[model samples]
Structure formats: structure tokens, C-alpha cells
Target chain A: MNGVFAKLRTGLAAAALASTALAGPVSAQQVKEFWHYLGAGGELEGVEGMMEVAKSKIDEEFTHRVVPGGSAGLRQQVQVSLMGGVPPMAYQVSAGLELNQLAQSGRLVPLTEAWEQINGDEIFPEGLIQVISYGDEKYGLPFAMSMLGNTWYNKGIFEELGLEVPTTWEEWDEVATTLEENGYVALTSGGGSAAWTIYQFYAALFDAAGADGYWEFVGGMMPLDDPRFVEAVDLFEAHFVKYFDDEWTGGVWSDGLDRLMAGEVAMYNMGDWASGYMRQRGWTPNEEYSFFPAPSLQNVTIFQSDVIVVLKGEETDLGMKFAAAAASPEAQQAFNAAKGSIAPSNEIDPSFYDPIAKMEYDKLVSEDAIVLPNLYVLMPSGFKEDLGNAFTRFGATKDRAAFDEELARLEEMRKEMYEAGEFGTF
Target chain B: MTTLNPLAAIPFRQRDRMTYFIFLMVPAVLYVAAYIYPTIETFRLSFFEWDGFSPPEYIGLENYWELLGEPRFRNAFFNNLKWLVFYLTLPTVTGLALALLLDAELRGSVVFRTIFFIPFTITTVAVASAWRWMYKPSNGVMTQFVEALGFDAPNWLGDPSINTYSIMGAALWAWSGFTFLIYFGGLRALPTELIEAARIDGAKFWTILFKIKLPLLWPSTIVVLGIAAVDSMKIFDLVWAMTQGGPYRSSSVLAVEMYETSFVMFKLGQGAAVAFVLLVVASIVVMPYIYHMTRQVDEVKE
Candidate 1:
């Protein structure tokens, strides 16, 4: 009876092996999970496109878990998951201090080998690469880069009003006046939306402070009483706050975008993702609408990127391969096309991008483009929130005294942060 | 018929006590694990600076000190106090008034009660969304109504001066239904003879309501106030969903501040400090009520 049972077991094992062989190599394929907060609309499409592109470049199968909540939500979920020791193969994060801090905590796997495999130094710009790197190691592979210092406008409105794309602050002010005289919202956004309102400040600050001064400001070396800083605040107020109509207060960012498309607003200064949103809504770029880099004293590109951070784990090798795939020119092209962002890699074929994106791509690679990370990307955690709150209040109340008080507070905070060496090599 | 009764040797009183304790053990353990442990952990975390992932550095009372000096914190703290005061009084009064009117057995009172109760049945998020539209400055129902009367409509939500009150109004609309149900149940349980006697003695409606009915409704009031107090203290969803405690932290409360600090800012220790402050405030406000309820229970037992 024992001999018969052993023979039966051997036969079953052989049958199982034959079935596995019939199933082919596909059955044995490694499956890696990626977690991201890009759950809806263009971002979701972009992420899916990137994953599909990655699959063609790598042997592993990638599955995605759409984490709800935007960056803040993703951060909370990632922190909890990492603490619980069940982190995924990779997760999405902004490509600066957000990644650098995680790397500092030693929770992330350095993508140095993956970077070398992908020829990262040659393809990706040195500045952006350094922004996403920690010390001498890479921890994030950027997939989508958004130029925040750009203003999207309705081409038809500009044509109808016989106005030109403003390339300077004076020209911009004149254009805004023309739009307002024609009973259009001059510069529109979700007035109650704190983050976008804060971006208005960052963009204007770049325009007002100039690239070098802005760098000094971010480095905490600029004095609080700097005229450029005051001018930036004034420009932010005039564009983002004072012109904001009461009707717009109850709306969100998308609502502002909708109003702009509908010709209710003349212009919206936002990240390139606004273009992604516009494209998703069937608006053709550079036809019905167009954009220009935010009016600046000198050419500047305030950019931020979304990166895939590989976790340090058993699936680390698979994660690196996935990151490498994301960094590949083909994947970057596909992802950026869907995302309405410019490819981070210089090797990407710009012919695949729309005209506006192609222009952005050119600017991104241009040595004359004074590239800097967006304020949120440049600042550490608390500083961003503090600045955002101050801007939010100023945008709503337009109280100069309160704004000055906040500036004072921020100056103190900057000193403390600088003293503690919190500005991590940005 | 049983082989041997193990519990039979035990005294009846002790055996009953043992059964009670065994039944209580499950919930007791669960309570300790879920609520008590987290509360204690939060209190401990309040004393340390943590960024969710990094090793927590001991910060002692610095987080608390910052909260004190922070204007946003003061704004949120005051907003919470306003919520507590309004929630404790407005809803209870509105509910009582509705209950009394219904108890009078006027025509269509049952339908009125159901209509009034509808807001409570809908989720707070839905209610807040609906009210937010109504409060909108441009073409909102409230704005149109005000304009129709030949007056300017205030920016119900946009104006920092009135945003908190506007939100409180929505909360009142959603909350009064619950309080009405409680009061209605309490009123129904009251003896009819007492109210009839007051009427026979020529007591006015107001007099009868204040003197005869309201005093008897203390138990229900206590229940309502207890719920309202806690609800106001931890109010987050409606405020967050509606204004996100904005146009600028104008309508922010302790709960919203805690959420922003912990989740949005990732200042876990500061968030914990905010939470502890809220917990302390809530305890101080509710302790007297708890004691009163305890006394009420003890008196009834005696």
C-alpha cells in the first residue's frame, strides 16, 4: 500500500511539472506591485501608459494599486505601510526633498545601479538628477516633469482681444488690464484653493526676484526687507488675490480651469499639469489654447517631477528593473505624452510630444533656462505648509500687516531651518 | 441528571458575579486595546517630535508651547469653543421647540417631524456640500434670497468674519433633527396628566412648556448635550469637506488643525499635542456632565 501511495505521489508531481511547462514562461513571470495616488483622469492614463511601456522593456509584470488621496494621502499611506513592513515594490513621490528625506531615513533603496544601467547621467539633466538624488546616490527615477512657471491662456481670447503673449511683467500687467477691461477675469484660479494660490507667489517671485535672487531667497540668504521679495508679494497679490472675484471663492482648481476654457477667465498660471487636465477635457493645445513661461526678468523654469521610489526589500531587484524601465526614453516619451509633462530625459524623442510640450522640452534642456524646483519641491515639509498658509491668508484677506507678520515669522523659521541644515542640498 | 455541576459548589452571588465578569471580559479587552491604548500612546507621542518615519526625538512641551504661540492654533481653538457653545445650546433648543410643537398634536405635525428629521438621515458630507452651494456668494440660493429682498448678500463662506457661523448654521440644520428625535421620544414618555393639569389651571402654553415639560426633559437634554459636546469637539468631516478650514484657517477647528499637522504636514508630535489638548478640553467640559449623570443614576438606584 505504501509503495502504491508513493507511485501515485510521483505521478501527481510529474503531472504538475508537465502542466507548469505547458503554462510557459509567462506563468513564472515576476509580478511587481506599484503604489501611486494618480487615480483619475490624465494622471491615471499616464501611469498606465508608463507601466505598459515598462512591460515591453522589462521581463517583470507590473501591477498598480491606486492609492487614494493626492500626495499628502500617498505620503500618509506610504508611511503607514513602510512602518507596517509591507511596502510595495515602488511608490510615487515628488522628485526632491520628498525623496531625499526618505532616502535619509534609509527606508528607500538607492537606484545607483539602475541609474548607471539606464545611462541616467547622460539622459537626465544634471540639475534635476541632483535634485532627485541624495548625497551621491539616486533614490528616485522621475517619470513626469511639470514646469510650474508657465501661464496657460485661451488663444482665441488673446486673438479676439488683439493681445500678444506677455514676456515681461509690464507686458503681463497690460494684458491683464486688457482682459479685465473686456470683462474677463484677468488672472483666474480657484481663489479658495491654497496650493495653487501659493504657486502664484512662487511663479511671481521668480519673475520678480530674478533667478539668482530667487535662489538666494530659497537658500535663506535673502533679507526679509528685500525689495524683490516685496515686489514678488505685491505681484502675487495683484494677480492672485486682488483680481479674484467673489464668485470664484466657492470653486476649486478645476472649476477655475473650466472658467478659463469657457472664456470667463483670460489666463491661468499653473503647472504643466493644467495642460494635462486641459487635454483630457478635449481642448487642443496651441490651437484653441496656448501657454508661455510665466513672465520673468530672465528665462526660468520652475519644475517639479513625480518619481517612482523603489523600496528596499526582497523584490528590490525587480523594483530596480521597473525603475530602469521608467527611466528609459521610450517609457518617458509615452508617460509624458499622456501626462502633458515634458520628458525628464534628454534622450526622449520630442517629436512624440505636442507642440507646447516640445517647446517645454527644448526649454528644459536649454542651458539658458534657469531651472529651479517648484517652491513645494524646494522647501522641506513644515516650511512649505507655513508658506502656503501665509499665502492662503494673504490671498483671501489681502491684509498687508498680516502678510508682513507672516514674513517676519517665516524669516525666523528660515534662520532656524538654516541653522539646523534642513535645506538638504537643493 | 448531569454528571457533576462544577458551579453548584459556588455561592449563587459569586457564581452570578463570575458570569457577569466573563461576559464583560471580551468588550473590556477590546476597549483597552482600541481606545485606551491609543489614547495613552497619543499622550506619550505628544511629548516627542516625530515625522512618521524617523526616530522620534523627545521635545517635551515644545509642541504645546508652539501651539500656544501659533495664531492659527488660537483661531482654531476659538472656533472649537464657538462650536461647543453653539452646539450645546442651539440644537437642543431647536429640537425642543420642534418636539413641543409636535407634541401639541397640531395638524400635519407627524409630517413636519419627518420633514425636519430628513437632514439628519443624509450623511454629513452630503449635507455640507448642499449647504456650501446654498452659501455661495454668486448665484447661491442664500445670495439670491438676500438680493431679492433688495439687500447685498454677504459672502457667506468667503468672508472670514462669517464663515464659521455659516458652517455652524449648516451643522445646526443637520444636527437639530437628531436632537428633535430625542426630545420627541422624551416628550412622549412624559405623563399626559401633568400637562392636562397645567392646562386646567389656566397655564399659558409658554408657561406649561417651561415649567411643566422642560424640567421633566432633563434626562433627554443631558443625552443631547453629551453627544453635541463631543461632536462639536471632534468636528472634522463637514469643516474639512466644505471649506477645509479655509479661505485661510478662518474656520479651522482643533480637529482640522490636528489633521493638517499630522497628515498634511507630517508633524506627528505636533498633531499629537493638538489631539491631547482637544482631549483635555473635552474631558474638562464633559466631566461635570458625567458626574451629574452618575449622580442621577445613583439617585435612581437608591
Candidate 2:
């Protein structure tokens, strides 16, 4: 009788397994494609990870696919792909030109219904919402938010060097000089093919240009002949050039943060993703590494955010569901904690973040913190490349001749593009 | 069921025509659709201003007009020209030398040939990574070797003046194996009697290489140079992976510039113009080699 019972139990278990296998494909026939820049071993793994967790919350019988690509590469790919009449359900794009152009093309589904689905106005700050929206329509869901002017350092290195958090230009210079004197690379910052690698200097330029000048400088309203612009360039030379490592010119932004984590350098200037990357690499935050808001501009926040845009199609329902889940307090908290970035939803409590991210996030929400867009985020991409070429020359040698000539060329191009109506009054 | 041939009802001559037409249709259509059409469309697009959005506008030759005075475009073009010169010389010479060395019947010749051919087997991405690490600042293999020899090494990828050559060195390292394999195959087909006759005449190895082998290797030389020249124009992956045409656009090539303009800058019209110019340059390069090869083939047939 016992042997008979065992055989019956085994048959029942096999029957259950077969039924589940039969039901999976039937249920998963409906699916959504989520395109993002996981970029192989990045701090943004949370974007994909939380998508997996959010799958359970997706009430529809829809499966999801994560399509990985780099930021700029994905933009180009999406451009070409959409030209072919097939686009992924959603993709990672920055707020400025990428979103603006895509929105203009009528390829994206505006977030009217999706924003309502996600509870956007209640959770996200107006600044973030403004960043992701254009033409008064929300077009994307913000996943990663950074107060872009934070400086990351090896806490152990700082303790060993007896360095304190620097607040002024003079103090920062002295601290950097001491680190260099002791056998440390005072700083590490680099850029690759993209429009990054100039942001670190942009932060300093912010301080040099002051609050009003910085805003005007980024907005194309600032004159090319502004003495403050020249001072800003000089400030970049004094801070970034003086302490740069030998390998600073040809790498992506992450390389510097990686070096900081490796303790080969004393300091780095980037967004809060540094802490996330450190955690991903098994470093305990505030122990192995630490971060501080970029000095002399604590009142100003240079913001960086990555957003997902829903494409209009039969799968819009599933895509909107994914976007809504991404904006949920639980999902945002889980994702941002893992990503080393702050949740886009401002309602998330500060305690959910690590010390570095919390401090940065608190400022982003603080009454006195003023939001400024980095050139990489706000400027037109063609304008960005023109600036990139000029910055490369400006970075190596602060040659006034080359600087002035490039500046003139840029202004001319901007004038032509503006007259042609390329910038579109944004 | 019996299979039937529609051409069976026709005369043999007409059937032959029909068979040939059917056989050639797919590829001919493909060539027109994939290659010829796009090339021609690019020319048309070059005259218009299009941002991949909105309707394209007729901008006359404004895109081409911008290039005449653009310093960055000039830098990229001249850099490509430098690559053209480098590819025509280094890989061919090094490859010819290695092929001659390995064309012997010595023991372990296969091992030597394999060792020399290994770099070509590795993909360009992996090879670029290896070379980039080898050229890393202050602590890389090349940097350390220079330092040991009592010299301060410039950052290979950071210095504008030297970065292109540094990238070319990596390209040549991977490409030499390919050139060697091509020459080795050519050498295998050479008449052994010529080598034996020279050796019997007390000819030195240098004389044998320069006079008999190299003179006979003319066909291979033309083909190899043409391949390298055309391949050199499309040199983007190595530069993109290694330096990204950087340290100040000193290493920027036409392809990288075209990519940035079209994709990053969204000036598809201008990017099309750059592509057109590169296409013209590539054609100018390959045309002479084709003429030379065809002439050689005719002489052989005669």
C-alpha cells in the first residue's frame, strides 16, 4: 500500500510539471521589449534587475525582454530601427535632444495615460518631470537621477592622507597638491566617444561662472565674449588640468570612478553612480569609498537622469505598466538602492539611500538647491560634438588662440543652426 | 508526381539563356538593392539637409561647402591618408619577410607559421583591448619597457601627435598575420625549380628573395596592397575601441568623423556627404589595382 501511494504521488508531481510547461508559452505569448543601456557591468544593473522584480506586478499576461545597449549607440540604433517601422516597446534615452527629437518625430507615445498610470505628479519633483517632458507632455519614465557634481574618493586614502572634505578652491587645491606630493594621482577624469568627459569641468565652470552666469552660459544666451566664460575655462585648467592623470583624455567617465575605487587616485568628480559602482564591485559605501557634493557650488545641482520612453503600439499597455512599476515607490527604492542613484520619485524617504546618495538626494529636494542641466543633457547633440572637439583641444592646452577660434566657429554654427530652426526654442 | 522543366520545351540555346538568367537573378537583384541603390541614394541625400526627422530640404551643395574650410574634417582626411601610406608599406613588407622565412622545409615550420598567424585569428576588438593595455600609461608593457631603457614615455593614446601611429601599430600587429598568410599561400604556388636553380647558382638568400621570389610575387603584391588599401579606409573599430579618435581629434579618421556627424550630430545630410567623399577616395584607390590585376591576367592568358 505504501509503494502504491508513492507511485501515485510521483505521477501527480509529473502531471503538475507538464501542465505548467504547457501554460507558460500560452501566457507569455504577449510580451514587451524594454530597451536600456545596461552597458555590461554598470551601476545601472538595477534598471534590469528591478524590471525582473516588477514582472510580478505586471497584471497583464505579458512577458518582458531587456535589450541592452550603450546610451548613444541605443539612440542611433533606435533611430535606424524606428525608421524601419519596428521599434522596441520602450528604450532608455536622455531627456534633451534624444527625447526632444524622438518626440518631435511622433514615434513616442506621450505619457498622458502612462503618467496617470504611474502616479507621476505625486511622486516625482516638478524639476525631474520638467526634465523628462517637452511640449507639456510627459514622454518618459525617469529611472536614474544624479546630482551630477558629486566628488567620489577612496575613504581609506583620505583617512591615510589626513584629508578633510574640501569646501573652497584654495582648500581643494592644497588637498590635491598634498595627495600628488605623497605619490597619488591627484585626480582622474576622462571621456570617450560620447558627449561626457566634459561634465567635470562643466561643474567647475558652474562655480566660476556663478549661478546666473552658468544658467545663461548653458542656455545659449550667454555671449561668446563673456569674461566669465574665460574665467570658467581658466578654472577648469586650475582644478582639472592641474591634477589630471596621464591617462585622462581617452577613457569614458566610468574609468575615473573605477580608478578611484581601485585607490590609484585620491578623488574624482562625477555623479552618485560612483557609489553604486563601488557597491557592485563589493566595496562598502562610506567605508572603502565616500562622496561629497562638488565644492563651491553646493547650492546648485547639475542634474543627470536616464528615462524610458514608451513606443506606441499594441504593446503600449505592457510598456506603460513597466514604466509605472519603475516609478512606484517600492520599485524606485529597490532599483535606486542597487544602482547607487537616487529614486526619481521624490517621495521616497532619504533613509532608503546610502549616505552619499541620501545627501545628494536631500539637496535635490531641498528648498535652496537650484537645478541646472549639464551641457550633455541640455545642449543639442551637434552642438555637443562641436563643444567636444573644442574641449579636447581646450583640455590639452588652454591655448587662447585655439579656444577663441573654436568658440567663434561654434557660435557661427549655432547661429546658422538656430536660424535654420534646429534648436526649436527649447 | 513527375517534375517538369519549363525550359525543356524551348530550344537548347534559348534554354541555356533562361537557365543562366534564373541563376543570376537573386544576386543581381541583391547587388542593386543592397549596394548600388544605397550608394546612389547617398549622393542624392548629400545635396539635402535632413536631420532624420521632418521633411528633408533641398540645401544645394551647402553640405559640401562646409567641408572646404572645416579644420576637423581636414584633420580626419589627412589622418586617413597617413593610414593609407602606413598600410601600403608596413604590413606588406613585414608579411613578405615572414612568408619567406616560413617558406622553408625546416622542422617545426608549421609551429612558426601558426605563431606568426595567431594575431590575425583574434578578433579586432580583443586585439585592440590587448594593445590598449600594452600601451597603458606609466605602467603598461610598452611604457615600462621604454622607462627601463631610460626614457620618459609619452602616453601612447593621450598624445595627439603620436596616438595615430600608436593605433596603427596595433592595426599592423593584427593585420600582419593576415598579410603573411596571403603571401604564404602565394609563395606555396611559386615554382620550386626557380628557387632550386638559384640555390645551385650559389645565390645568397637575399638575392633569392629580392630577385626570384619577389619578382614572381608581383600578382600577390597587387592584390594584397589593394585589400589593405580598401580595408584601411574602414579603420574605425580599432580607433573607436582604443582611442575614440581622440586626445584632440588627432587620430580622427573619416569613418569616425562620418559616424559622429551622422549619428551623434544627427546631420544625416552632411554625414552622407562625408561618406560620399570616402567612397570616391576608396574608388580611386581600388581602380588602379583592378587595372593592374586585369592587365596581369591578360598577359598570363596570352
Candidate 3:
């Protein structure tokens, strides 16, 4: 009688195990974890909006982790997570150097298959796609972009001086002189630690160096001592630096914009974000203030984009689906609309863009447009930092000898970095 | 009274020893985990080449060798030395002067003392930002004052040649209040008869101060100098918030270099190497004070 009871209990246990196995996957929902630098402000709203648009498209439920500290903070957190062997499915990273670093570390898997599925090659600019690519594989999906190299100016200041928007370097020189003669600060950028603002000067440099020269320079092929590069540097030192505010080094990027807004300064060379700053302050775009691409870079589109990078993880397939959603037109529209940045895709309608962003979109789609990644997103982080420092020093001193020495040092540094296999193809 | 005392059976001395041991155990474990272990790890990692993400490659002193060749590191090292010298001298002297001035018996002197000490009470970052605005080239208070005095106002924080000194000026302002408080306490605690005797001997005010008061203030001096030395070595928040070791690292110091290398440049091994160098240098600077204080305590006990 005891053996009969034991057999019955064992049979019941087997039936229960079978039922549990059948119910597990159906009952449990797969959660895809994503990391982003957007926490507070419009960026948070933007990410949330993007996720809302992407929710139906992606098969799995996803949770977004707001990583504080911008790109630097995101990089540090991602490093810690990767070291712990629990990297998130995807994270927001800049398109070029930041993404390349992770890809080179073997932490990120290529999203090329996903990219092809979204018709990314057809929609995104070729240069932008390359910026997000590592070696032969695509590692990032471009989402939002800001057009660089535009000179944001006070329309009030221009009207007071009767200066039309300069369409040529010579015309800009006259306009700058006129503004200066009228006792208005002609051109300015934040120096000191905020010296990276001087990369706007590189737009002019890019114009001096044609597409080929610019490519060679950024690709670590062209030496800084090259005559063409020197000429570009000379233009930056001579023309732009001539009109730079004597006290510019004391202020930061926002201060420069503030000066422009107050009509004390005539022009500021900054990214599209300056317009957002202006709009926030109740300054009407195209009426109170307006921007135009540097006359020399009128045909060249210098852009910085935020990208979604898929890391190696258990839920990589879901991560790819999210990347696809991020790259899709609907999601891009929703994200960029809230984020105050223009969509990376050319297919996105321009009706929703602000006046300045609309101008950027038109220029981006123009036949003559030669799109290039901004210097910040083009070179390795170390080299980029060194270059910014060099420029800041040169901005203050204007000593040609010291500038040349910096150039030589940077050339050698770039060579070493390239030899160490720290770069991707231009 | 017939009472059961569990610990009484143990000798008083043994019980006392156990009590001390129990008190020290937590801190000992914490010190090893928080300080000693991490320091050892930092020293070990300094010999490897790691970029935070990849497995550390054992490079074995290559990081140090490279640092020696790097111009930026040398610049930062010298800047740190400049900070050390300035901290050791300027704050000490200015604080002594202020203490001497405030030591006088006068009305409303306490209010003046409080006013001077206010800066020290503020956070370093706040102090830095305040000073940064005052050093702004265009409309800074300093610039406006100099310009109003019929002189051309040179760029305070913009000129690389002068920026370190400019920042040091701010540091002095922030830190002198601390030293002044110490010196004031030292002055108040002094025996009045000594100074009275010096005055009765026809000694001048200068002579009395130099020959009598200054020598007696050694303990306060030591306290101020020891703190200033360590503070100088680890100076980061001020320089970082103000100039970020820029106008091309002209104001760069060892601590700033360490942070930038580790977090900004993502060269963890190289950054650790910098941190180790800082630890060694700081230890060298602080060790003598530690020994001196411990020796004083031993003598007192004797």
C-alpha cells in the first residue's frame, strides 16, 4: 500500500512539471533595457516620445535608463556595465569617435543588417552613414543631427547697420568691418575651457580645403604642415581672429550667444542649439536673429548626429528592432520634434522644422551639398581635445610659431594614434 | 551585594583590551577596503595599459616612461610645484599679517574677522566661480578697477603666462582665512607676560613680533602648512571649475591631469600612473609633518 501511494505522488509531480514548462515563456514578458544620456529637460521628453512611437513597432517591452553626465557619463556607465558583462541592449552615443571606441573594444555588434532593412543607405546622407560605420560594418543608427558652421547673428544689429546677410567671404569681411565701425563687436567665440566653440572656425577651414583636402586632413593622411592646411589655419588666424572680441576668452559658449542677443556682438558661430537658446529667451528666429552657413562653407554641410548603438547583449534582436524604430521616419519625426533637433533622415518632412532647421534641411538636400561630419565627431577624442586646446591657446596668443609647433605635435600624435589602429576609414 | 558580573571574571586589563579591539575593528576593515586596497590596485594597474573597456595589458613602466616624454605631463607637474610654492608662502604670510592686525584690542574687530572668514565657509566650486567672474577680462571687478586707475588691464585668466598666478591669487583669498583663524587662536592662547616683558626691555614692535611671538606660533604654523601642503597637491575643483587646466593646460596641475586622463581620455592605466605619482609626491610632502606631530605627542606623554 505504501509503494502504491508513492507511485501516485510521482505521477502527480511529473504532470505539474509539464504544465509549468508550458506556461513559463507565455507568462513572462521579455524586457529590453536601453541606456541614454537624456534625463531632464526636452531631451527626456524626446526620448520618451521616441519610445512611444517605437513601442508598437518593437516586439518586446523596453525600459529606458537615464544615464546622467551627458556623453562622458554615458561612456563611463557603459564601460562599467560592459565590464560587468551586462551591457544594455542599446545606448545613445555620438556617431563618430565615441561609437568607434566601443566598436574597437569589441563591445558593440554591427547593425548593418538592421540598417539595410530600414533603407538607411537611401535615407541618411552617405557621409553621415560613414560617420556611424566602423571598418566595414555599421555600428550606429543615426537619429538626430545639428547643422554646424552657421553664423548666428542678431537681425537687429544687422538692420541697424544696413548689412544684408553676407553670401561671400569678401562680402562677410565688408559686413564685419561695417559692424565693427558701428561700434558693434563683429565676431566672437567662447575661449578658455569652452574653446571647442572655435570648431566653427573649422567650417571656414573646411571651405578653404575642398572636400578632398578636408577628408585627407580628418582621415590623418594630410599633415598639418601641408601648405593647404597652413593656408586654412592662416585664414582662421588672420581673418576670423582679427574680429574676435578682445575679451572673448573670458566667456563661455552661452555668453557669446548672450552678447549677440543683446546686440552688443554682431555674430556668433555656433550650432543650431544657439537658435533654441534664442527661442527660449523669446527671440524670434529670422526676425530678431538669423543664421547662415559660413560663406565659405555654404555648400558644405557640417553636422553632428546622435546615434543609437546596439551593444552585444542577450536581447540584441530586440535592440536591433528598436534601432530600426529609431531610424524610422515616424520615430525620427517624433524624437527630433521634441528634441529640437532635425531628423537625420532626408525622407522626413521639413514642415515641422524651425526656420533655421528648415534652412539646414534644404541645404542638406541641395544638389551642391557636400556633407561632412563636424570635427568634434570626426577625429578620435584625444586628438580632438588636443586640437581644441591648441586652437584656444593660439586664439589668445596668435603666435604663428607656437601655432606651428602645436600643429607639428598634433601631426605626430595623429600618426601614432593611426599606427595604433585607433581610427576608422574617413 | 551578591551580583553576577560576566566580564568581572576576566581581568580588568584584558577586558579593557577587548573593548579597544572591538572599537578599532570596524575602522580597520573600512580603511583596508576603502583606502589601502584601492591604493594597492591603483599601483598595480599603473603598470598595465587599460582603456577602461579592454582587458589590461601588462606594459610594465611604459606608462611612466611615456609620461616622462609627454610635454603636457611636465607642464602639469611644474604647475603643481608652482601651486605648492604659492600655497606654502602666500597664504601663510598673508594669514600671519591678518592675524597680527586682528589681534589688536579694538571695537568691531570680531565683525572684520567674520567678514574675512566668510569665503572659507563657502564651497570651493562656488569660490572658484565667484573668482572666475572677478577675473573676467572685459568687465571683471579687477579689470574695472585697474582700468579706472588709468592703467591697461591685462587679461587675468586669459593670458596663459599669468593665468596660473591669477588662479593662485583666488586660492590665496579662499585659503588665507583658514590660516588666519588658526593664527588668531594661537595668538589668543599666548601668555601675556612674555610680550609684556619684551616691551619692557625696550624692544620695538617688530622685534617683539619676530623675536617673541613668531617663534611661539610654530604649532599653529605647522597645522596651517600641513593642511595647505595637502590641499595644494590635491587642488582640482578650483582649477577645474575656473580654467579646466587650460588656455591649453597652462594652469594644469597633477590632479587635473589625472582626472582628464582617466575620465576624459579614457586611459585608465595612464591615469592610475598619474594618481600614483601624485600619491607618492603628496606622501613625501606630508610625512615629515606626521612624524613631527607624533614625536611631539610622545614627548608630551614622557
- Each prediction's TM-score versus the true structure: 0.90, 0.89, 0.90
Interface RMSD of each: 8.0, 7.8, 7.0
- The digit string of per-residue lDDT tens for model 3 on A70-152 reads 77788888776654456688889878776776677776779999999988889999889878887788999988998788899
* Model 1 Cα lDDT, one tens digit per residue, A1-426: 999999989966775455333322111222268889988766788788888988888876668889898888888877666655566888898887667778887767899888988888888776678678888898898888888767889998999999999877778889888888999888765655567777877767876787677667766676667898888888877666776655555555676688888888878877777877888789998898888876662366778888889877778888888889888888888777776678888887788888788878778777786777776666766776777767767766678798999889888888888888787675
Error of 3 at B76 (Å): 1.1
For model 1 chain B, give the 10-residue run with minimal summed lDDT. Answer: B48-57
The residue-by-residue lDDT of candidate 3 on B208-260, one tens digit each, is 89998999999999999899889989999899888888777888999999988
In candidate 3, which residue pairs clash?
none
- Each prediction's Cα lDDT score? 0.81, 0.76, 0.82
TM-score of chain B of 2: 0.95
Per-prediction DockQ: 0.22, 0.19, 0.24
How many pairs in model 2 have backbone atoms within 3 A of each other, for residues 3 or more apart or on separate chains, i.e. clashes?
A: 0
For all candidates, the clash counts are 0, 0, 0
Which parts of model 2 are misplaced by more than 4 Å?
Answer: A1-31, A39-45, A48-58, A113-122, A193-197, A250-254, A261-263, A314-322, A424-426, B1-6, B104-107, B299-302
- lDDT per residue (tens digit) for residues B1-302 in model 2: 55498656789999888889988998999998799867877887788777664456779999999876788799999999999999999999999889988888778999989998999999999999999888877467998999999999877887888989999999889999988998999999999999999999999989998998888888789888999999878889998888878866778999988987887677888999999999998889788988888887899999
